[model samples]
Target: MPVDPDKARALAFPPVTVTVERGRLRMFAQVIGETDPVYVDPAAARAAGHPDLPVPPTFFFSLEMESPDPWSYLADLGVDLRRVLHGEQEFSYHAMVYAGDTVELRPRIIDVYTRKGGALEFLVKRTDIRRDDRLVAEATAVIVVRDPEVAS
Candidate 1:
Protein backbone atom coordinates (compact mmCIF):
# COMPACT_ATOMS: atom_id res chain seq x y z
CA MET A 1 0.00 0.00 0.00
CA PRO A 2 1.26 3.46 -0.82
CA VAL A 3 0.08 4.62 2.56
CA ASP A 4 -0.14 2.70 5.81
CA PRO A 5 -3.75 2.26 6.75
CA ASP A 6 -3.02 2.96 10.39
CA LYS A 7 -1.24 6.20 9.63
CA ALA A 8 -3.92 7.33 7.19
CA ARG A 9 -6.66 6.64 9.68
CA ALA A 10 -5.11 9.12 12.06
CA LEU A 11 -5.49 11.93 9.57
CA ALA A 12 -8.19 14.49 10.16
CA PHE A 13 -8.92 17.79 8.48
CA PRO A 14 -9.65 20.89 10.51
CA PRO A 15 -13.26 21.97 10.65
CA VAL A 16 -14.11 24.60 8.07
CA THR A 17 -16.85 27.23 8.20
CA VAL A 18 -18.29 28.57 4.99
CA THR A 19 -21.08 31.02 4.25
CA VAL A 20 -23.08 30.09 1.22
CA GLU A 21 -23.07 32.92 -1.27
CA ARG A 22 -25.85 33.65 -3.73
CA GLY A 23 -23.64 34.72 -6.59
CA ARG A 24 -21.60 31.57 -6.40
CA LEU A 25 -24.74 29.50 -6.12
CA ARG A 26 -26.25 31.23 -9.11
CA MET A 27 -23.14 30.64 -11.14
CA PHE A 28 -23.15 27.04 -10.14
CA ALA A 29 -26.76 26.71 -11.23
CA GLN A 30 -25.90 28.28 -14.54
CA VAL A 31 -22.87 26.11 -15.14
CA ILE A 32 -24.58 22.85 -14.23
CA GLY A 33 -27.62 23.74 -16.35
CA GLU A 34 -29.89 23.64 -13.32
CA THR A 35 -32.87 25.24 -15.02
CA ASP A 36 -34.64 25.39 -11.65
CA PRO A 37 -35.33 29.01 -10.81
CA VAL A 38 -35.14 28.15 -7.10
CA TYR A 39 -31.41 27.74 -7.52
CA VAL A 40 -30.93 31.08 -9.20
CA ASP A 41 -33.58 33.35 -7.79
CA PRO A 42 -34.25 34.09 -4.13
CA ALA A 43 -37.82 35.08 -4.90
CA ALA A 44 -38.52 31.78 -6.55
CA ALA A 45 -36.90 30.06 -3.60
CA ARG A 46 -39.08 31.94 -1.16
CA ALA A 47 -42.13 31.00 -3.18
CA ALA A 48 -41.08 27.43 -2.78
CA GLY A 49 -41.00 27.90 1.04
CA HIS A 50 -37.26 28.24 1.25
CA PRO A 51 -35.53 31.01 3.12
CA ASP A 52 -33.28 31.68 0.16
CA LEU A 53 -32.14 30.00 -2.98
CA PRO A 54 -31.94 26.43 -1.81
CA VAL A 55 -28.38 25.36 -2.15
CA PRO A 56 -28.32 23.40 -5.38
CA PRO A 57 -27.39 19.77 -4.87
CA THR A 58 -23.67 19.02 -4.70
CA PHE A 59 -22.87 22.62 -3.84
CA PHE A 60 -21.30 21.40 -0.63
CA PHE A 61 -18.53 19.80 -2.67
CA SER A 62 -17.50 23.13 -4.06
CA LEU A 63 -17.70 24.76 -0.64
CA GLU A 64 -15.43 22.10 0.77
CA MET A 65 -12.97 22.59 -2.07
CA GLU A 66 -12.59 26.15 -0.92
CA SER A 67 -11.86 24.89 2.55
CA PRO A 68 -8.72 26.23 4.18
CA ASP A 69 -5.72 24.22 3.05
CA PRO A 70 -7.65 21.83 0.87
CA TRP A 71 -4.55 19.61 0.71
CA SER A 72 -4.10 19.33 4.45
CA TYR A 73 -5.88 15.97 4.60
CA LEU A 74 -3.50 14.43 2.04
CA ALA A 75 -0.53 16.03 3.67
CA ASP A 76 -1.38 14.44 6.99
CA LEU A 77 -1.64 11.07 5.28
CA GLY A 78 1.64 11.63 3.44
CA VAL A 79 -0.06 10.85 0.14
CA ASP A 80 1.22 12.07 -3.20
CA LEU A 81 -1.18 13.83 -5.46
CA ARG A 82 0.31 12.39 -8.64
CA ARG A 83 -0.61 8.91 -7.53
CA VAL A 84 -4.08 9.74 -6.24
CA LEU A 85 -7.32 9.28 -8.13
CA HIS A 86 -10.71 10.62 -7.09
CA GLY A 87 -12.58 7.35 -7.23
CA GLU A 88 -16.02 8.36 -6.07
CA GLN A 89 -18.14 10.85 -4.17
CA GLU A 90 -21.51 10.69 -2.45
CA PHE A 91 -23.73 12.93 -0.38
CA SER A 92 -26.44 12.30 2.19
CA TYR A 93 -28.71 15.21 2.94
CA HIS A 94 -30.48 15.54 6.27
CA ALA A 95 -31.99 18.99 6.01
CA MET A 96 -32.45 21.87 3.61
CA VAL A 97 -29.89 24.66 3.48
CA TYR A 98 -30.18 28.13 2.10
CA ALA A 99 -27.89 30.79 0.76
CA GLY A 100 -26.23 33.03 3.39
CA ASP A 101 -26.29 30.30 5.99
CA THR A 102 -23.02 29.55 7.69
CA VAL A 103 -22.15 25.87 7.70
CA GLU A 104 -19.30 24.01 9.32
CA LEU A 105 -17.67 20.89 7.94
CA ARG A 106 -15.80 18.32 9.97
CA PRO A 107 -13.95 15.73 7.92
CA ARG A 108 -12.45 12.51 9.16
CA ILE A 109 -11.06 9.31 7.79
CA ILE A 110 -13.71 6.64 7.66
CA ASP A 111 -12.00 3.72 5.99
CA VAL A 112 -8.68 2.60 4.52
CA TYR A 113 -8.03 -0.58 2.61
CA THR A 114 -5.71 -2.12 0.05
CA ARG A 115 -6.15 -4.37 -2.95
CA LYS A 116 -4.05 -6.27 -5.49
CA GLY A 117 -1.20 -7.18 -3.16
CA GLY A 118 -1.15 -3.70 -1.70
CA ALA A 119 -0.55 -2.10 -5.08
CA LEU A 120 -3.80 -0.22 -4.80
CA GLU A 121 -4.88 1.76 -1.75
CA PHE A 122 -8.36 3.01 -1.08
CA LEU A 123 -9.03 5.82 1.36
CA VAL A 124 -12.46 7.01 2.28
CA LYS A 125 -13.39 10.20 4.09
CA ARG A 126 -16.70 11.27 5.52
CA THR A 127 -17.40 14.94 6.05
CA ASP A 128 -20.23 16.06 8.24
CA ILE A 129 -21.76 19.43 7.59
CA ARG A 130 -23.72 21.24 10.26
CA ARG A 131 -25.71 24.42 10.46
CA ASP A 132 -25.97 25.79 14.00
CA ASP A 133 -25.60 22.33 15.51
CA ARG A 134 -28.05 20.71 13.13
CA LEU A 135 -26.77 18.06 10.77
CA VAL A 136 -27.36 19.17 7.23
CA ALA A 137 -25.38 16.77 5.11
CA GLU A 138 -22.70 14.14 5.12
CA ALA A 139 -20.40 13.84 2.14
CA THR A 140 -18.18 10.92 1.35
CA ALA A 141 -15.18 10.90 -0.93
CA VAL A 142 -13.17 7.88 -2.02
CA ILE A 143 -9.56 8.18 -3.10
CA VAL A 144 -7.59 5.48 -4.83
CA VAL A 145 -3.80 5.58 -4.84
CA ARG A 146 -1.58 3.51 -7.10
CA ASP A 147 1.72 2.39 -5.74
CA PRO A 148 4.54 3.72 -7.89
CA GLU A 149 6.75 0.73 -7.14
CA VAL A 150 4.07 -1.59 -8.50
CA ALA A 151 4.21 0.17 -11.84
CA SER A 152 7.84 -0.69 -12.34
Candidate 2:
Protein backbone atom coordinates (compact mmCIF):
# COMPACT_ATOMS: atom_id res chain seq x y z
CA MET A 1 0.00 0.00 0.00
CA PRO A 2 1.13 3.50 -0.74
CA VAL A 3 1.57 5.97 2.11
CA ASP A 4 -1.30 8.39 2.61
CA PRO A 5 0.45 11.66 1.91
CA ASP A 6 -2.44 13.67 3.35
CA LYS A 7 -2.59 11.76 6.64
CA ALA A 8 1.17 11.67 6.95
CA ARG A 9 1.19 15.41 6.40
CA ALA A 10 -1.30 15.93 9.20
CA LEU A 11 0.42 13.79 11.84
CA ALA A 12 1.41 15.34 15.17
CA PHE A 13 3.50 13.88 17.96
CA PRO A 14 3.91 14.58 21.68
CA PRO A 15 7.01 15.87 23.37
CA VAL A 16 9.16 14.10 25.95
CA THR A 17 11.37 15.21 28.83
CA VAL A 18 14.69 13.85 30.12
CA THR A 19 16.61 14.69 33.26
CA VAL A 20 20.39 14.66 33.16
CA GLU A 21 22.01 12.64 35.91
CA ARG A 22 25.58 12.01 36.95
CA GLY A 23 25.48 8.33 36.07
CA ARG A 24 24.02 8.98 32.65
CA LEU A 25 26.62 11.65 31.99
CA ARG A 26 29.38 9.29 33.01
CA MET A 27 28.06 6.54 30.80
CA PHE A 28 27.71 8.82 27.84
CA ALA A 29 31.23 10.09 28.33
CA GLN A 30 32.51 6.54 28.38
CA VAL A 31 30.64 5.66 25.21
CA ILE A 32 32.04 8.69 23.42
CA GLY A 33 35.57 7.89 24.64
CA GLU A 34 35.86 11.29 26.29
CA THR A 35 38.76 11.55 28.71
CA ASP A 36 37.99 15.11 29.76
CA PRO A 37 38.06 15.58 33.52
CA VAL A 38 35.10 17.93 33.28
CA TYR A 39 32.92 15.06 32.12
CA VAL A 40 33.39 13.01 35.26
CA ASP A 41 34.67 15.42 37.88
CA PRO A 42 32.24 17.97 39.25
CA ALA A 43 35.05 19.93 40.90
CA ALA A 44 36.96 19.97 37.63
CA ALA A 45 33.83 21.11 35.80
CA ARG A 46 33.33 23.98 38.25
CA ALA A 47 36.94 24.95 37.96
CA ALA A 48 36.54 24.90 34.21
CA GLY A 49 33.57 27.30 34.43
CA HIS A 50 30.81 24.76 34.14
CA PRO A 51 28.22 24.16 36.81
CA ASP A 52 28.59 20.39 36.38
CA LEU A 53 30.00 17.71 34.17
CA PRO A 54 29.37 18.62 30.55
CA VAL A 55 27.90 16.01 28.27
CA PRO A 56 29.25 15.46 24.78
CA PRO A 57 27.67 17.00 21.71
CA THR A 58 26.20 13.70 20.57
CA PHE A 59 24.40 13.25 23.88
CA PHE A 60 21.47 15.07 22.34
CA PHE A 61 20.56 11.84 20.55
CA SER A 62 19.77 10.27 23.91
CA LEU A 63 17.29 13.03 24.67
CA GLU A 64 15.73 13.00 21.22
CA MET A 65 15.15 9.26 21.32
CA GLU A 66 13.01 9.80 24.39
CA SER A 67 10.31 11.25 22.17
CA PRO A 68 7.32 9.09 21.32
CA ASP A 69 8.19 6.21 19.01
CA PRO A 70 8.08 7.48 15.44
CA TRP A 71 7.29 4.00 14.22
CA SER A 72 4.12 3.78 16.29
CA TYR A 73 3.17 7.29 15.32
CA LEU A 74 3.58 6.55 11.62
CA ALA A 75 1.68 3.34 11.91
CA ASP A 76 -1.30 5.42 12.91
CA LEU A 77 -0.98 7.15 9.54
CA GLY A 78 -1.22 3.78 7.77
CA VAL A 79 2.48 3.54 6.94
CA ASP A 80 4.16 0.24 7.72
CA LEU A 81 7.03 0.48 10.15
CA ARG A 82 9.02 -2.10 8.23
CA ARG A 83 9.00 0.13 5.16
CA VAL A 84 10.63 3.10 6.87
CA LEU A 85 14.33 3.84 6.79
CA HIS A 86 16.34 6.50 8.57
CA GLY A 87 17.69 8.54 5.69
CA GLU A 88 19.57 11.26 7.52
CA GLN A 89 20.31 12.81 10.90
CA GLU A 90 21.84 16.17 11.72
CA PHE A 91 22.23 18.14 14.92
CA SER A 92 22.80 21.78 15.80
CA TYR A 93 24.03 22.75 19.24
CA HIS A 94 23.60 26.11 20.89
CA ALA A 95 25.53 25.32 24.08
CA MET A 96 26.98 22.52 26.12
CA VAL A 97 24.83 19.93 27.85
CA TYR A 98 25.79 19.50 31.47
CA ALA A 99 24.77 17.25 34.30
CA GLY A 100 22.14 18.48 36.80
CA ASP A 101 20.14 19.85 33.90
CA THR A 102 16.60 19.00 32.86
CA VAL A 103 15.78 18.87 29.20
CA GLU A 104 12.48 18.99 27.34
CA LEU A 105 12.20 17.94 23.72
CA ARG A 106 9.38 18.70 21.33
CA PRO A 107 9.30 16.81 18.04
CA ARG A 108 7.15 18.15 15.25
CA ILE A 109 6.68 17.37 11.60
CA ILE A 110 8.14 20.34 9.80
CA ASP A 111 7.48 19.15 6.27
CA VAL A 112 6.31 16.14 4.25
CA TYR A 113 6.71 15.58 0.55
CA THR A 114 6.73 12.75 -1.94
CA ARG A 115 9.39 12.20 -4.53
CA LYS A 116 9.19 10.32 -7.80
CA GLY A 117 11.01 7.49 -6.12
CA GLY A 118 9.18 7.54 -2.77
CA ALA A 119 8.13 9.60 0.23
CA LEU A 120 10.40 11.92 2.10
CA GLU A 121 9.52 13.02 5.61
CA PHE A 122 11.26 15.81 7.45
CA LEU A 123 10.99 16.35 11.16
CA VAL A 124 12.26 19.26 13.17
CA LYS A 125 12.89 18.37 16.77
CA ARG A 126 13.78 21.10 19.27
CA THR A 127 15.36 20.39 22.60
CA ASP A 128 15.64 22.87 25.44
CA ILE A 129 18.14 21.88 28.08
CA ARG A 130 17.55 24.16 31.05
CA ARG A 131 18.63 24.66 34.60
CA ASP A 132 15.96 26.30 36.75
CA ASP A 133 14.32 27.86 33.68
CA ARG A 134 17.62 29.22 32.41
CA LEU A 135 18.38 28.09 28.87
CA VAL A 136 21.47 25.95 28.83
CA ALA A 137 21.32 24.72 25.27
CA GLU A 138 19.02 24.51 22.29
CA ALA A 139 19.46 21.55 19.93
CA THR A 140 17.63 21.01 16.65
CA ALA A 141 17.60 17.75 14.78
CA VAL A 142 16.56 17.17 11.18
CA ILE A 143 15.46 13.63 10.53
CA VAL A 144 14.71 12.32 7.06
CA VAL A 145 12.40 9.36 6.75
CA ARG A 146 12.57 7.49 3.48
CA ASP A 147 10.47 4.77 2.01
CA PRO A 148 12.08 1.34 2.07
CA GLU A 149 11.49 0.64 -1.60
CA VAL A 150 13.27 3.79 -2.64
CA ALA A 151 16.06 3.21 -0.15
CA SER A 152 17.09 -0.07 -1.75
Candidate 3:
Protein backbone atom coordinates (compact mmCIF):
# COMPACT_ATOMS: atom_id res chain seq x y z
CA MET A 1 0.00 0.00 0.00
CA PRO A 2 1.17 3.50 -0.79
CA VAL A 3 2.02 5.51 2.27
CA ASP A 4 -0.20 8.27 3.47
CA PRO A 5 1.89 11.37 3.16
CA ASP A 6 -0.04 13.24 5.80
CA LYS A 7 0.27 10.44 8.36
CA ALA A 8 3.95 10.09 7.69
CA ARG A 9 4.37 13.81 8.37
CA ALA A 10 2.76 13.52 11.76
CA LEU A 11 4.71 10.57 13.12
CA ALA A 12 6.51 11.10 16.43
CA PHE A 13 9.25 8.90 17.87
CA PRO A 14 10.11 8.15 21.46
CA PRO A 15 13.28 9.49 23.06
CA VAL A 16 16.44 7.45 23.73
CA THR A 17 19.12 7.85 26.38
CA VAL A 18 22.66 6.53 26.82
CA THR A 19 25.26 6.58 29.55
CA VAL A 20 28.68 7.50 28.28
CA GLU A 21 31.39 5.26 29.73
CA ARG A 22 35.18 5.17 29.50
CA GLY A 23 35.32 1.88 27.61
CA ARG A 24 32.81 3.12 25.05
CA LEU A 25 34.77 6.33 24.60
CA ARG A 26 37.96 4.40 23.97
CA MET A 27 36.17 2.13 21.51
CA PHE A 28 34.66 5.06 19.65
CA ALA A 29 38.02 6.77 19.40
CA GLN A 30 39.53 3.64 17.90
CA VAL A 31 36.70 3.28 15.40
CA ILE A 32 37.08 6.89 14.25
CA GLY A 33 40.84 6.50 13.86
CA GLU A 34 41.58 9.05 16.57
CA THR A 35 45.17 8.57 17.77
CA ASP A 36 45.00 11.33 20.39
CA PRO A 37 46.09 10.31 23.84
CA VAL A 38 43.23 12.28 25.42
CA TYR A 39 40.75 9.94 23.78
CA VAL A 40 42.46 6.79 24.99
CA ASP A 41 44.35 7.62 28.17
CA PRO A 42 42.72 9.04 31.31
CA ALA A 43 45.95 10.59 32.54
CA ALA A 44 46.45 12.42 29.28
CA ALA A 45 42.90 13.74 29.39
CA ARG A 46 43.41 14.96 32.95
CA ALA A 47 46.60 16.70 31.98
CA ALA A 48 44.64 18.46 29.27
CA GLY A 49 42.18 19.78 31.90
CA HIS A 50 39.57 17.08 31.33
CA PRO A 51 38.19 14.97 34.13
CA ASP A 52 38.26 11.76 32.11
CA LEU A 53 38.76 10.42 28.63
CA PRO A 54 37.63 12.88 25.97
CA VAL A 55 35.72 11.94 22.87
CA PRO A 56 36.38 13.31 19.44
CA PRO A 57 34.16 16.05 18.00
CA THR A 58 32.36 13.53 15.77
CA PHE A 59 31.87 11.03 18.53
CA PHE A 60 28.35 12.30 19.19
CA PHE A 61 27.12 10.37 16.19
CA SER A 62 27.76 7.20 18.10
CA LEU A 63 25.25 8.34 20.69
CA GLU A 64 22.55 8.51 18.03
CA MET A 65 23.03 4.85 17.24
CA GLU A 66 21.66 4.15 20.70
CA SER A 67 18.48 6.00 19.85
CA PRO A 68 15.26 4.30 18.81
CA ASP A 69 15.44 2.58 15.45
CA PRO A 70 14.90 5.45 13.02
CA TRP A 71 13.56 2.99 10.46
CA SER A 72 10.82 1.96 12.84
CA TYR A 73 9.80 5.55 13.20
CA LEU A 74 9.58 5.86 9.41
CA ALA A 75 7.54 2.67 9.26
CA ASP A 76 5.02 4.34 11.55
CA LEU A 77 4.86 7.07 8.92
CA GLY A 78 3.96 4.50 6.28
CA VAL A 79 7.29 4.81 4.53
CA ASP A 80 9.03 1.61 3.48
CA LEU A 81 12.53 1.32 4.94
CA ARG A 82 13.82 -0.65 1.92
CA ARG A 83 13.19 2.40 -0.28
CA VAL A 84 14.82 4.88 2.06
CA LEU A 85 18.25 6.32 1.39
CA HIS A 86 20.38 8.57 3.52
CA GLY A 87 20.61 11.86 1.69
CA GLU A 88 22.69 13.86 4.15
CA GLN A 89 23.85 14.27 7.73
CA GLU A 90 25.02 17.40 9.54
CA PHE A 91 25.89 17.98 13.16
CA SER A 92 26.20 21.14 15.26
CA TYR A 93 28.18 20.76 18.47
CA HIS A 94 28.06 23.16 21.39
CA ALA A 95 30.66 21.47 23.59
CA MET A 96 32.99 18.53 23.89
CA VAL A 97 31.76 15.06 24.87
CA TYR A 98 33.64 13.03 27.46
CA ALA A 99 33.34 9.73 29.28
CA GLY A 100 31.09 9.23 32.33
CA ASP A 101 28.43 11.57 31.06
CA THR A 102 24.80 10.47 30.73
CA VAL A 103 23.27 11.83 27.57
CA GLU A 104 19.56 12.17 26.88
CA LEU A 105 18.35 12.18 23.30
CA ARG A 106 15.10 13.78 22.27
CA PRO A 107 14.25 13.27 18.64
CA ARG A 108 11.57 15.08 16.69
CA ILE A 109 10.29 15.01 13.13
CA ILE A 110 11.31 18.37 11.81
CA ASP A 111 9.71 18.25 8.41
CA VAL A 112 8.21 15.88 5.81
CA TYR A 113 7.96 17.07 2.24
CA THR A 114 7.73 15.45 -1.15
CA ARG A 115 9.06 16.38 -4.53
CA LYS A 116 7.78 15.24 -7.90
CA GLY A 117 9.53 11.88 -7.67
CA GLY A 118 9.97 11.09 -3.97
CA ALA A 119 9.72 12.17 -0.35
CA LEU A 120 12.18 13.81 2.04
CA GLU A 121 11.96 13.46 5.77
CA PHE A 122 14.04 15.77 7.97
CA LEU A 123 14.65 14.99 11.59
CA VAL A 124 16.29 17.19 14.23
CA LYS A 125 17.63 15.26 17.16
CA ARG A 126 18.82 17.11 20.26
CA THR A 127 21.21 15.39 22.61
CA ASP A 128 21.88 16.83 26.01
CA ILE A 129 25.01 15.41 27.62
CA ARG A 130 24.52 16.13 31.27
CA ARG A 131 26.17 15.34 34.54
CA ASP A 132 23.57 15.54 37.29
CA ASP A 133 21.53 18.27 35.57
CA ARG A 134 24.66 20.20 34.64
CA LEU A 135 24.66 20.79 30.89
CA VAL A 136 27.82 19.40 29.37
CA ALA A 137 27.15 19.63 25.68
CA GLU A 138 24.38 20.04 23.15
CA ALA A 139 24.46 18.22 19.87
CA THR A 140 21.92 18.82 17.13
CA ALA A 141 21.79 16.48 14.17
CA VAL A 142 19.90 16.85 10.94
CA ILE A 143 19.15 13.69 8.98
CA VAL A 144 17.65 13.65 5.54
CA VAL A 145 15.87 10.52 4.33
CA ARG A 146 15.24 10.40 0.62
CA ASP A 147 13.14 8.07 -1.47
CA PRO A 148 14.97 5.83 -3.95
CA GLU A 149 12.71 6.63 -6.86
CA VAL A 150 13.71 10.25 -6.65
CA ALA A 151 17.27 9.38 -7.52
CA SER A 152 16.34 7.55 -10.68
Candidate 4:
Protein backbone atom coordinates (compact mmCIF):
# COMPACT_ATOMS: atom_id res chain seq x y z
CA MET A 1 0.00 0.00 0.00
CA PRO A 2 1.14 3.51 -0.82
CA VAL A 3 1.36 6.22 1.78
CA ASP A 4 -1.35 8.84 1.69
CA PRO A 5 -0.34 12.25 3.01
CA ASP A 6 -3.95 13.42 3.15
CA LYS A 7 -5.04 10.41 5.17
CA ALA A 8 -2.18 10.90 7.58
CA ARG A 9 -3.04 14.57 8.01
CA ALA A 10 -6.69 13.74 8.64
CA LEU A 11 -6.04 11.27 11.43
CA ALA A 12 -6.28 12.37 15.04
CA PHE A 13 -4.38 10.62 17.78
CA PRO A 14 -5.46 10.78 21.40
CA PRO A 15 -3.30 12.69 23.82
CA VAL A 16 -1.12 10.75 26.21
CA THR A 17 -0.60 11.69 29.83
CA VAL A 18 2.27 10.54 32.05
CA THR A 19 3.65 11.45 35.43
CA VAL A 20 7.40 11.73 35.51
CA GLU A 21 8.88 9.42 38.14
CA ARG A 22 12.16 9.83 39.99
CA GLY A 23 13.03 6.15 39.89
CA ARG A 24 12.32 5.95 36.20
CA LEU A 25 14.44 9.00 35.54
CA ARG A 26 17.27 7.57 37.54
CA MET A 27 17.03 4.29 35.72
CA PHE A 28 17.00 6.00 32.39
CA ALA A 29 20.01 8.03 33.35
CA GLN A 30 21.80 4.87 34.31
CA VAL A 31 20.77 3.01 31.16
CA ILE A 32 21.99 5.89 29.04
CA GLY A 33 25.17 6.12 31.12
CA GLU A 34 24.36 9.62 32.30
CA THR A 35 26.36 10.63 35.35
CA ASP A 36 24.76 14.04 35.88
CA PRO A 37 23.72 14.28 39.52
CA VAL A 38 20.67 16.41 38.84
CA TYR A 39 19.08 13.69 36.74
CA VAL A 40 19.54 11.10 39.47
CA ASP A 41 19.59 12.86 42.80
CA PRO A 42 16.87 15.13 44.12
CA ALA A 43 19.26 16.93 46.44
CA ALA A 44 21.56 17.74 43.56
CA ALA A 45 18.59 18.77 41.47
CA ARG A 46 17.40 21.11 44.24
CA ALA A 47 20.87 22.60 44.53
CA ALA A 48 20.79 23.15 40.80
CA GLY A 49 17.50 25.05 41.07
CA HIS A 50 15.19 22.22 40.11
CA PRO A 51 12.26 21.10 42.22
CA ASP A 52 13.05 17.45 41.65
CA LEU A 53 14.91 15.10 39.34
CA PRO A 54 15.12 16.75 35.96
CA VAL A 55 14.43 14.84 32.78
CA PRO A 56 17.51 13.94 30.77
CA PRO A 57 17.94 14.57 27.08
CA THR A 58 15.58 12.58 24.85
CA PHE A 59 13.64 11.31 27.86
CA PHE A 60 10.38 12.72 26.54
CA PHE A 61 10.52 10.18 23.71
CA SER A 62 10.33 7.41 26.24
CA LEU A 63 7.56 9.13 28.16
CA GLU A 64 5.54 9.54 24.99
CA MET A 65 5.71 5.79 24.49
CA GLU A 66 3.79 5.41 27.76
CA SER A 67 0.65 5.67 25.70
CA PRO A 68 -1.45 2.50 25.56
CA ASP A 69 -0.38 1.82 21.99
CA PRO A 70 2.62 3.79 20.89
CA TRP A 71 2.81 2.30 17.40
CA SER A 72 -0.87 2.26 16.60
CA TYR A 73 -0.51 5.32 14.44
CA LEU A 74 1.73 3.41 12.05
CA ALA A 75 -0.83 0.68 11.71
CA ASP A 76 -3.54 3.23 11.08
CA LEU A 77 -1.49 4.47 8.16
CA GLY A 78 -1.10 0.97 6.71
CA VAL A 79 2.62 1.00 7.41
CA ASP A 80 4.41 -2.33 7.71
CA LEU A 81 6.54 -2.24 10.81
CA ARG A 82 9.07 -4.62 9.34
CA ARG A 83 9.76 -2.24 6.50
CA VAL A 84 10.04 0.91 8.54
CA LEU A 85 13.08 2.61 10.01
CA HIS A 86 13.52 5.47 12.42
CA GLY A 87 14.83 8.19 10.15
CA GLU A 88 15.34 11.03 12.57
CA GLN A 89 14.19 12.67 15.79
CA GLU A 90 14.69 15.98 17.54
CA PHE A 91 13.45 17.81 20.62
CA SER A 92 13.21 21.45 21.64
CA TYR A 93 12.46 22.57 25.18
CA HIS A 94 10.85 25.76 26.36
CA ALA A 95 11.04 24.71 30.00
CA MET A 96 12.51 21.98 32.14
CA VAL A 97 10.55 18.87 33.04
CA TYR A 98 11.02 17.34 36.45
CA ALA A 99 9.99 14.16 38.15
CA GLY A 100 6.51 14.31 39.73
CA ASP A 101 5.25 16.56 36.97
CA THR A 102 2.31 15.34 34.97
CA VAL A 103 2.77 15.99 31.28
CA GLU A 104 0.55 15.55 28.27
CA LEU A 105 1.81 14.64 24.79
CA ARG A 106 -0.26 15.52 21.76
CA PRO A 107 1.15 14.14 18.51
CA ARG A 108 0.19 14.91 14.94
CA ILE A 109 1.40 13.87 11.53
CA ILE A 110 2.69 17.17 10.27
CA ASP A 111 4.14 16.16 6.91
CA VAL A 112 4.48 13.21 4.59
CA TYR A 113 6.45 12.84 1.39
CA THR A 114 8.11 10.34 -0.86
CA ARG A 115 11.71 10.04 -1.90
CA LYS A 116 13.75 7.70 -4.15
CA GLY A 117 11.02 7.54 -6.77
CA GLY A 118 8.38 6.27 -4.37
CA ALA A 119 10.63 3.55 -3.04
CA LEU A 120 10.87 5.38 0.25
CA GLU A 121 8.22 7.38 2.10
CA PHE A 122 8.94 9.73 4.94
CA LEU A 123 6.39 10.53 7.62
CA VAL A 124 7.04 13.40 9.95
CA LYS A 125 5.29 13.57 13.29
CA ARG A 126 5.38 16.49 15.71
CA THR A 127 4.45 16.05 19.33
CA ASP A 128 3.83 18.94 21.68
CA ILE A 129 4.47 18.41 25.36
CA ARG A 130 2.41 20.39 27.82
CA ARG A 131 2.50 20.73 31.57
CA ASP A 132 -0.74 22.02 33.04
CA ASP A 133 -1.74 23.22 29.60
CA ARG A 134 1.49 25.17 29.15
CA LEU A 135 3.80 24.23 26.32
CA VAL A 136 7.05 22.87 27.63
CA ALA A 137 8.57 21.06 24.70
CA GLU A 138 8.13 19.79 21.19
CA ALA A 139 9.38 16.52 19.70
CA THR A 140 9.63 15.81 16.03
CA ALA A 141 10.31 12.40 14.49
CA VAL A 142 10.65 11.05 11.00
CA ILE A 143 9.70 7.52 10.09
CA VAL A 144 10.91 6.10 6.79
CA VAL A 145 9.09 3.25 5.15
CA ARG A 146 10.52 1.24 2.29
CA ASP A 147 8.46 -0.09 -0.51
CA PRO A 148 8.46 -3.87 -0.28
CA GLU A 149 8.72 -4.40 -4.00
CA VAL A 150 11.49 -1.88 -4.51
CA ALA A 151 15.00 -3.16 -4.81
CA SER A 152 17.27 -2.09 -2.04
TM-score of each prediction: 0.92, 0.71, 0.74, 0.95
Worst 10 residues of 4 by lDDT: 143-152
Q: Which regions of candidate 4 are displaced past 4 Å? A: none
Count of clashing residue pairs in every prediction: 0, 0, 0, 0
Q: Please write out the lDDT profile of model 3 over residues 1-152, one tens digit for every residue.
A: 33454565466656567888899888877887889898899999999999899767766667767765745876676556665666545566556667887776655555555554555555444555554566655666544555554553
User: Best candidate per TM-score, number?
Assistant: 4
Q: Model 1 segments beyond 4 Å from truth?
A: none
Candidate 1 displacement at residue 52 in angstroms: 0.6
Question: Tens digits of per-residue lDDT for model 1 on 5-110?
Answer: 7777777577899999999999999998889888999998999899998886688888788786887777667778888999999999999888899999988888
Candidate 2: tens digits of C-alpha lDDT, residues 1-152? 45555665466666567777888888877877888888878898899999888877677777666665735666676556665656555566666777777777655555565665665655444455555566656656544556555653
Report the Cα lDDT for residue 81, model 2: 63
**Which whole-number lDDT from 0 to 100 does residue 78 have in model 3?**
54
lDDT of 4 by residue, 38-101 (tens): 8888999999999999887699999999999999988998988998999999999999999999
Worst 10 residues of 3 by lDDT: 116-125
Q: What lDDT is reached at residue 59 by model 1?
A: 85
